[model samples]
Target chain A: QQQVKQSPQSLIVQKGGISIINCAYENTAFDYFPWYQQFPGKGPALLIAIRPDVSEKKEGRFTISFNKSAKQFSLHIMDSQPGDSATYFCAASKFNTGKLIFGQGTTLQVKP
Target chain B: EPEVTQTPSHQVTQMGQEVILRCVPISNHLYFYWYRQILGQKVEFLVSFYNNEISEKSEIFDDQFSVERPDGSNFTLKIRSTKLEDSAMYFCASIGASTDTQYFGPGTRLTVL
Candidate 1:
């Protein structure tokens, strides 16, 4: 029930294109969802997050669309750039426990 | 901006040896956690600490693993006997009063041979 499944395993996009990654969870107990971006040999950095309370959230060029009833959420990177090329992870956790269950990261490669 | 810090960017130990990974969480953050990721795998939660005690732990935490907040600032994960499978990137995370947002530190790469 703690699983947060994400897809596709790998993504390729051209510059100035929109890149979208989707995730779904089986655990309804999860009230907090966050997306992380990680470069090679570094830790995951917070990208953007959304909760069940809101359907969508936008942070600069990154946006998160959440569907509470469907137990689904997605991260969209607008005007994808080579700098945005990295492993993106979708995580779910309960507010009280704060133990994040991460998805099988999606590696995004934005071609120059 | 305050962030979590970890020591010994890399550690190499022989099988059966003991290893400890240390972390200094963000000041004023009340909750701390430990997680691990094997090469090319998803990050897995090991444990969570609060108020100088373990608030929660995962099955992977097992008897060989332990956590401590010896001082007010440093949080540590100790593996009494390192196994070959224990080699992974261990991460420390913290959540402040918000109870939702968690900040992760640059992980300690443990290589058990």
Candidate 2:
């Protein structure tokens, strides 16, 4: 129940296109959700995040759409660029405990 | 732009040897954590520390593993005896007083042979 399952093991999007990745979790206790972007040989970096209380959160080109009832969330990247190509991870955690359960990760490739 | 930092970008140790991975979280961050990721695998939560104490740990954080905050600025994870299976990328993360964001270090790649 602690697993955060992510979809599209790999994704290829054209430049100026939209790229999306989905994730689901069975742990209802998870109140915090975050997305991370990792370059090769580098640790994951915080990209965007959303709480269960909000349906969606957007920051520049990255947005997180969350559905509390479905226990699902997704990350959407607008105007996909080659620089955005990397492994993206979705994670869930409880606010108080702060232990993150990460998804398998999605390798996104934006073609130029 | 305070970010977490880790030492020895890569560590190579033989089996049964002891090794310690070190990290320095953001200065003002109050929560610290350690997570591991095998090649092409998901990030596995190892442990979380808050207020200088372990708040929680996963099954993967076995008896062989120990965490310490010996000083105000550093946090460390020690393996009493390393094994071949311990080879992976170890990451240290930290979050400030707010609970939503966690900043991760560059990671220490542990290669046990």
Candidate 3:
């Protein structure tokens, strides 16, 4: 049972374009949604996170748009750069659980 | 900037041997966790440790696997008998009590033959 599902296993975008990755979850108990970026041979780094109370959060060029009613969230990267080419993973976890349920990763490629 | 640190970025061991992976989480963090990622697979949670004990563990964490916080700074995962299926990249993460964001270590790639 994959609690969180992500679409478009791979993505390609031109430089300065908007790169978008979408994720959905079935568990209503999930309150914390986060996006992680991982480069090859390294660990996943926290990119952006949003709580259920907020409809959207923007950090630098990264934005997370969350829709609680639809049980969906999406990550948008504005001005996508070639350096941003890597794997992105969306994760969800409930309070006090300390266990993150991750979605299938999306590999993004930005062509300069 | 505080970050999680792991030892032996890569380890190669034979089947039926014992291997212990070590991690040093951030100094101020209290919650610790272990996760594994197989080649081209999503990260899977193995166990979570809090208050000096395991709070939760996944079904994949069997009796052959064990986690211990031997000291104030070191968290270790020991696999009693390594199997070929245990080959994967193991990551350690830590979070503070006030935040839900987890900081991850650089991961250790374990290869079992």
Candidate 4:
């Protein structure tokens, strides 16, 4: 079973537009949600993270809006740029579990 | 910034051969983990190690697989007999004492023929 589900396998947005990716998880034990960005032939890098305690967290131009009761979270990129074109993965994990359950992934393309 | 380092960016091994992948985690990190990603697939967790012992592992980690912290800084994963299905990109990650964020290595592309 896929523990976490992501929507819009691919996305395209114009520069200065907002790009969004959403993910949902079935396990309530998940307390930490993180978004990772991966470029071709490279490892995934941490983009932003949020705990269940907060409904929203923002870092730079990236923001994570989490709804604990709905078991859903979404990543929003403001003013999307061509450099933002990459694959994004949303992950969930229980505290101290040491392992993350990752979503299928979303490929984003920012057209200049 | 300190980052995890993995050896041999790519390895091509024959079937039924034993292969060991090595990783050197950050100096102050306490948790180490191994994950794999098949082509165009989501990253899958293999195992997690802490304090020289395994803290968690996934179902995909079978008897043919084993992990060891041979020294203070080196963590290794061994596959007793590799199969064609083992071909994938293996990534090593480490987390420090203060944060839950994991820093990942560039990954070693293992090709089992």
Per-residue accuracy of model 2 over A28-62 as CA lDDT, tens digit each = 99999999999999999989989998999999999
- Model 1 TM-score is 0.98
DockQ of each: 0.85, 0.88, 0.87, 0.86
lDDT string for model 4 (B1-113, tens) is 88899988999999999999999999989999999999999999999999888999999999999999988899899999999999999999999999899999999999999
Across residues A7-106, which tens digit of lDDT does each residue of candidate 3 receive? 7899999999999999999989888999999999999999999999999999999999999999999999999999999999999998778699998899
Question: In candidate 3, residue A54 scores what lDDT?
Answer: 96
lDDT of 1 at B34: 97
Lowest lDDT 10-mer window, candidate 2 chain A?
A91-100
Q: Residue B33 of model 4: what lDDT?
A: 95
Whose DockQ is higher: candidate 1's or candidate 3's? 3
Itemize residue pairs with steric clashes in candidate 2: none
In order, candidate lDDTs are: 0.94, 0.95, 0.96, 0.94
TM-score of chain B of 2: 0.98
Give per-residue CA lDDT, model 2, range B3-24, as digits (tens): 8999989999999999999999
TM-score of 4: 0.98
Best by DockQ: 2
